[model samples]
Every structure is written in structure tokens, then in C-alpha cells.
Target: MKKRFCIASLLLLCLTSPWIAVAQTVILESPVRVVTSSDRSIFPESWLSPDINAEAEVLQESQIEPSRRVLYKVMKKYPGHILARNLETIYVLHRLKYKGISASGTNSRRNVYVVNRGSRERYTDAWIERTFHAEFSSKLLRNFPQYLDNDVWKKANVESFKYGVSGVKSVKQKKALKMFDPSLHAEGFLYAYAKSTLENDFNSIAEQLFLGDSRFWSVVNKHQRIKEKTDLVIAFYHKIDPKFSRSFFVSLAEVESAEIG
Candidate 1:
């Protein structure tokens, strides 16, 4: 009985040793929450370091902008944090928006339709290959943020603009048509509209653009049968250049032909 009790105690100590080690390591990463004298919670405990808690408290007591500054400062302290990873994603998307027309159809208006498809395999792989960083743990952080960034997610778009006139030939246009979804054609048009009229460039006003009785389905439906349709409302100013107008119909026709074949 004495021998058995000694062995049992030894086993418990062995099992707990690793846990205690892990706990000690975790304390190095754990942050403390600071409550300001003014009754404000300066920063959540989960996001800050024990050393920074006092700084957060001081910032809060001084009535400074706590949330934004905390995020910025915390990133400075623990640049490898998951929050820093997400912030990098945000920064990348913002950079890509000005690059124009994502291959993933980000700002191109096909976003709503693309969501219906079960697989985002192509887009996911593209992001993982191009934008994957060591810090992001959640798949949601990588994928959905592409949609939110407008059209900065597309590779073909970058290629098209780089090649310019050389890339606008028939063969290239046909390939471009394939990347586009039939349902999102109107959103593309609306995007162009928003660009030409409001800001002389594309910007998302998703709320106003998507309003209507059919919930913006009418806008999408209008482009369903271009041959039967007499007039098109392209761009924001409705400036219908007959030449540019033909490009829209021709592109859709190529898509239909490709689908049939």
C-alpha cells in the first residue's frame, strides 16, 4: 500500500508538470484589462498585455480615442497577434480596391450570385496563394474579406489592365466572359454607373444600389435577354456609346454560346 501510494503521487506530478509549463508560457502572452477611473473599460483583457494595461488606463482617463489607438498600439507591442493578422487583411483589401475589377468579382457586382455557389475553391486558393499569412487562423478571415474589399481579389483584372490594348483582343475577351456570372451583369453595370456619375470612379453604395421592389433582381433581370431589350442603362450618367454598348451585348452572347456548347 505504501509503494502504490508513492507511484500514484509520482504519476500525478508527471501529468501536471506539462500543464504547469504551458500555463507559465501562456502568462507571457496574457494581457490584463484596465478599468478607467471614469467608469470606462479601456481595453478588454483578452487583447492586451499586462504591461500595457496601465497605458490603456491612462489613455482612457485622458478621454482619448481608446479603441482605434489601442488596436494600433497593441499591434506595435505584439505584431504577431491574430488581430494584427486581420488588420493586414484589411490593409491588403484597401490597397486592391484601386487596382480595379477583381477576378473573383469582388466589386464587379457579381458578389451576391457568387455566394450562392457552394464552392469558393478557386477564390480561396487564390487568396491562400497570394495573400496567405502566418497569422490568420480562421478561414472566414481570409475568404469573406475578399468580398468586402470590392474587386481587389481578381488576378485577371490586374492582368487585363497591365496588358491594356494588347489584352483586349477577341480571345482574351472570351476568357473574360467566362469569369463573369450571368446574374451579376447588372451589378457590374451599376458599379460602372456609380463610377462615372458620383466619384468619377467606382465606389460601393451597396444600400442605395440594391434598393427596389424586386430587391434589385429587376436590375439583374433587365440584362437577361439583351437582343429583345431595346435600350440599356449603362454607366451612371446613362451615356450610351453605341460602340461600347455593343461590347456588353457581344460579351453576353459569347457567354450564352459557351454555355450552349
Candidate 2:
């Protein structure tokens, strides 16, 4: 009986040791991650319509107004790009693109644009821009599924000199490069929208946009600077549509860095 008791005590000590170590483990997670999946949002339908009167009528008639409206907007800070009178319309246009037609440019480079003639509001241009971004994101996911896998980011280096090795006209042939570099362009936008410093909690926005999770909106709501976070994320995403209307990047670092508190 004495030997059996001693063995049982030893086994208890071994189990408790692991628990003690686990209790001491440092859990480095942001407060932003606490957002529940129920917090995710699909932009409201009224946001897409250019006619405010029509939208209001529809809302009153149907008794439909979402509790939240994705809480993000993408538009041109400058004059040349598109503009939306109501921010919600931007997302509406995006949702519309999944069903609308996509037209690529005549050049070898694939520059896609959505055709939405039914839209009458001045903000129509901005909505179209939003659609362009949605289309580009869709294509990238289809063409480069590899980017979504394995966090190990692999970069390639290729140099082409105009001059030949033997001083011969290096211009053996100017291999006509494709219209654009989708990945590089996508990275540029991603970097631009990324919070200026690691301290900023913009990664929460990145996760929803790139990680295929809509719940990030709840995280945005928790932040004291909700508008700032929402504006930054949307502006940055929209900026890239015209230049890289075919694709964008969602880095592994971005996946790991989003704050949930």
C-alpha cells in the first residue's frame, strides 16, 4: 500500500508540472481578435444604388436596413479616380460585380473593368472602381492559389541587361513584357494601406479583406478610432484598382499581424 501511494503521488506531480508550464506560457495576442464571427458583415444592398430617393423608398417599403454596413469605403483621394456620393454604394457596386460583366483592356496586359450601365448616380464611377477591385481580387485568388498556401514567402530575382554579353547589340530581342506586373502592383497597394507603423492596428482590416473572413468588422468597432481604421483600409484598397485591376497580395505577415481586441 505504501509503494502504490508513492507511485500515485509521482504520477500526479508529473501531470501538474506540464500544467504549471502551460500556465506560464506567454500568450501574445491582440485585443482585436476577440471579435465574434457573428460580427462579420456583408455590405448592405441599399449602398449600391445611386438614387437616394429610390434607396430610401426601397428601405421604407421593405423595412430592410442592416445593423452594420461593412464599415469600409474605397474612393479616390484625388480628382481623377471615381467618386461615390454615399460610401455604402461602393460596397454595393462590389457585390454587383460578382454578377456583372468584366471587360479587359485591348493591350496584352489584362486590365479588367466592370460594365454597369444601369447605375445613374454620380457615385456610379466610384462604384465601378470598387467593382474593379473586387474583380482583381477574384482573379488573383483563382490564378495564384499558391499565394494563399504556406507562409514561406518565396521571392524571385531576374535581371535583363539591354547590352549583350559579347558587347554585341544586347538587344538580341526586347521580349515584349506583359502589360503589367500584377504581384508587384498588388504588393504596392498592400504596403500603402498597411498602417504606417506596426503599432497601428490596421492588420485587423487586412485580415477581413484578404483572409476570407468577414468578422474583422467587429474588431473595427472595438477600436476607439473606428473611422480612421475603416477609412485607411478602404482608401488603400481602392487606390490599387486602376493600376492593378487584375490582382493584389495578402502577405503571410498580414495574416499573422491582425489585432482582434
Candidate 3:
């Protein structure tokens, strides 16, 4: 009875108050949440620059393979030289002699990387040091099986596969076929030179220089073979760039050994 009387009194008060006739109102609002690292962004947004956007548009229109796009970008960075340009021109003229593409001016040198699947490249710098190795060397090694047994990495790789640690399932199929000869040669160089490096996490200068030679297949797992290839590469570098001495690589290895010790 008392509760009903209180409610009645409140209603009566409201009805009697002149301020109530002014139209009472109530408003509700949600509180904003504070975001931190725990709050993830919906999208990764990059700064929109006009030049970058234009290049991206061109690449999108070309519809080339990832390898071709990478090759084109690499070729574009190669410094223009009279020898490289002239040699490329002469080669192109001879190749297209039947088609009358003259040997004058800038021939297909600049556009060599732009060839279709038929005019595939015989060599690329990526065979040495690329952004993605597993994709660059080892992937090609798979398609080219003949080189698989020749690398210093061969024994370890086979052991890994046998133990099921390499994560490669097609060991049997890979052993059965040969790949392009150049791939075999390059892969052989990598695995051989890979053994001769500064005892650090990074690749040594010697390893990088060794890759310049294509006939690194002469290198076997034997200690003397690795030294022979190593010496030849160092000599070539000496002829081209006088600053690079054998001691340069030796000192780097010594420094790495001391640091680790």
C-alpha cells in the first residue's frame, strides 16, 4: 500500500510541476573503447604515391609471370655499357638475320629479359644471391634433378629426406630425371661454395665470388677441390677488382672465428 502511495505521490508531483510541462527528455550514449596493440587493424594500408601507383599499374597490365617481372626489374637496373650493348646487338642481329632486324643502334639488349617462354635465359644473378633462396635455387634444383647428386649439399639433403626432416616428399621422383645443364652447374656451385664460408650466420665474400664461375662443377666434396675452385674465383676477382685480395676473405673468417670463440 505504501509503495503504491509513493508512486502516486511522484506521479502527482510530476503532473503538478510546471517544469515537467517543458517536456523532460533522457539521452543515452555508448562509451568509446581505448585501443592498444591488442586491437588489430582491419587492413594493412600503404602511403599512396603517384609514381609507385603508375609503376604498379604497368606491371598489372603486363600480366607476366613473377620470374619475368623480377627479371625485367633486374635488367632495368643493369648499367648500360658499350661492350654489353654492342655484344647484345650483334647477337640479336645474327639471331634475327632471317627477319631483317638490323645490327644498328640499340638492339634487343635492353629487352633480352622480356623474351617469351621460348627465349628462356641461360643465366641470371639470382643464381648467386637472391631475395628468396628456397624459391630461387632449390626450387629449380627440383625441376632439374641431374644436379641433385653433384652438390656438397647432396649428402645432407638426401639424409634429411630419408629422415623426413627436409619436408620434401618426392625424393624418389627427383632422383630419376636430369634437369637443364646450366641449372646443374649453378646448383653444384652453390652447394660446393656453401661449404667454404665464414663461420657466421651470413654468407662470406668468397662464396659470393665463387658463384661468378659457371664451371664450379669441377668442385667435389673433397677438401682440395673446394680449395681449387676457391682460388680460381679469388684470382678472377683480383683481375676484375684489384681491391679484393685473398686475405680479405681469410681475415673475415678469422674475425668470425675469434668472435665465436
TM-score to true structure, per model: 0.18, 0.21, 0.23
Residues 1-261 of candidate 1: C-alpha lDDT, one tens digit per residue: 999999999888856552222211111121322111211122234323443221111112222222223323323322243233233211111111112222221211111001101113333322221122111212322333332232332221223332223212322344333222444343343332221221111222222221111223344445532211112222321231233243443454455357556
Candidate 3's clash total is 1
Q: Global CA lDDT of candidate 1, please?
A: 0.26
Q: Mind giving the per-residue lDDT tens digits that candidate 2 earns over 1-261?
A: 999999999888766552222221111112101011110122134424453111110111111111011212222221222222111121121112211212211000132223333333322433333333444443333444443321211111112212123111111232212122233232321222222222112332333444432333333344434434445444454454444211232332243356331
Per-residue lDDT tens digits for candidate 3, residues 1-261, read: 999999999899866653233231111110111011101111112212332111100112122334344333333322333124222211111111112221111112121111111223332334312222212222222333442233343332323232222211222223212122333333332332232221100122233332322223233323343454455445644553455467654554455457556
* Ten-residue stretch with the least lDDT total in model 1: 109-118
Q: Going through the candidates in order, what is the number of backbone clashes in each?
A: 8, 10, 1
Which residue pairs overlap in candidate 2's backbone?
31-260, 31-261, 32-259, 32-260, 32-261, 33-260, 33-261, 47-89, 163-170, 164-170
Model 1 TM-score relative to the real fold:
0.18
Clashes of 2: 10
The residue-level lDDT of candidate 1 at 126 comes to: 21
Candidate 3, residue 159: how far the Cα is off, in Å:
27
Which regions of candidate 3 deviate over 4 angstroms? 1-222
Report the candidate with higher TM-score, 1 versus 3.
3
